[model samples]
Target: MTSKNRDLRHLHEFDAERLITLGRAVIETETAAIAALAPRIDAEFARACRFLLNCQGRTVVLGMGKSGHIGGKIAATLASTGTPAFFVHPGEASHGDLGMITPDDVVLALSNSGETDEIVALLPVIKRLGVPLIAMTGKPRSTLAQAADVSLDISVDKEACPLGLAPTSSTTATLAMGDAVAIALLEAREFSAEDFALSHPGGTLGRRLLLHVSNIMHTGDEMPVVTETTTLREALLEMTRKGLGTTAVVDADNRVAGVFTDGDLRRTLDAGIDVRSAPIAEVMTRQCKTTRAEALAVEALSLMEDHKINALLVVDDQQKLIGVLNMHDLLRSGVV
Candidate 1:
């Protein structure tokens, strides 16, 4: 092996218990820091939420370095939870990005020292714009905190970093505090799941909540259907042609009367019935589960699961067959 490989293998030879102990210590230290922040969610935290909730415009989040990473996540959480927010690097703000901020906007600044040079430099401009300022910092008496309309304390007892240089507990505490503020505003605004789905239309939850039965159900000639008086043989042919393993049995008025499926055929053969001359109505399941085209696709999935069926027919208010859907359709549409 090469010298470098030998060195890497030697490094790996360190006691495994030592590595685990170190990892656990970091987690425990960060956990304590987050726990300490819970009690600090006082009147000031409420005032911060109020400011963000009442803002007529977006919340412009500003931070530097490690705090900037945390701020971006906080901004995303806020935006997805009903608050309009976005992150702007403090350094970029000094280079004309400050134009993005408006008098109607609220500024949330984060800096562990409360004196990040870039953010501190933008204070005069923000003040001149008459925008409300909310500062999140470890130092409550620092310049950024003193200039803010409300200051949030994100202080940690110590760094999880053994050398006390890297951001560990401080960043974790900041993130937790940001979530507390975002969730508090979410509850205050009574944000619902539907509202959240609108912001995440491409995610799984959005597919489940926003997609309706009409969007994925087979309609027109694609639907497998037969008249109530159709021969059992003809219903089986229709099921094969549509590949849905089931066929809707409708009355003379095109109203859904019952459903015939592959399972019914098996039962018929087992009972020694003749498929060539038997009527579909005799073997079709009466009062089969059905859904409306306008209902959510997830609701249809619920019905199929609850009734232990694999397919459902869509009907109108008058119980007329409009469309047909099977478990395969839901699986293809990501509703399953």
Candidate 2:
């Protein structure tokens, strides 16, 4: 083996117990650091939230190195939760991106030392713009904290990194503090699930919340429907034609009278009833589950699941058949 390969194999020679203990130590250290931030969520945290909640424009986040990565995540959490925010790289901001910040925007800067050169240099410009500045740093008396309208102490006793050089505990503490601020602002704004869904329309939660029965239900000719007086064979034919495995049995006024499904047909066959002559009304389920067109598709899914049924008829307030949906429709629509 090559020298590098020999070194790699030797490096991994530690027993499983040793590796596990190291992993657990890191987690415990980081957890304690996050716990330490709870007491620090004082008036300063409230003041920071106020600045963000009252800002006319977006919250511009600035950070450098490892802090930049944490800032990006904080910005995303704020934006998704209700507060409008985005991350701006400190180095980039110096060249030309600084113009992106306006007087209406609030500046949130993150630095472990609160003395990151790129961020400290922008302090004068941010102050001159007359916008509120919020600083999250380990040092309370650092330049960034002193110049800010609100200073959040995210200090950690020590990092989980054995070398004490890599950012571990401090970054975790900062991230937790950011989440605390974001959720506080979210509650203050009374942000609802529907509002969050609107912001994340492409996500699964959005599909479950925003999708309605009308959007995916089969309508008109696509719906498998037959009159109550129709023969069982005719109803089966309608189900086959539409491929929904179920057919709505309606009355003369097109009102839903009952429903006939493949399961009902099995019961009819077992009862020795002739499909060609038996009226659909006699075999259809009189008390079937249904939903409205305006109902959420997830609600329809829940109703179907509760009733142990695979299909549902959509009717208006007058009980007239307007549409029909089945499990396959929901599965295809990504609402299942």
Residue-wise C-alpha lDDT for candidate 2, range 270-319, written one tens digit per residue: 99999999999899999999899999999999999998999999999999
Error of 1 at 46 (Å): 0.8
The local distance difference test score of each candidate is 0.95, 0.95
For model 2, state the Cα shift of residue 306 in Å.
0.8
Question: Per-residue lDDT for 1-336 in model 1, tens only?
Answer: 999999999988878898899999999999999998987889999899888988999999999999999999999999999999999998989998999998889999999999999999999999999999999999999999999999999999999999999999999999999999999999999999999999999999999999999999999999999998899998999999999999999999999999998888899999999999999999999989999999999999999999999999999999999999999999999987
Backbone clashes for every candidate come to 0, 0
Error of 2 at 157 (Å): 1.0
Q: Worst ten-residue run, lDDT, model 2? A: 9-18
- Total backbone collisions, model 1: 0
Worst 10 residues of 1 by lDDT: 10-19
Tell me the spans in candidate 2 whose CA falls farther than 4 Å from its real position.
none
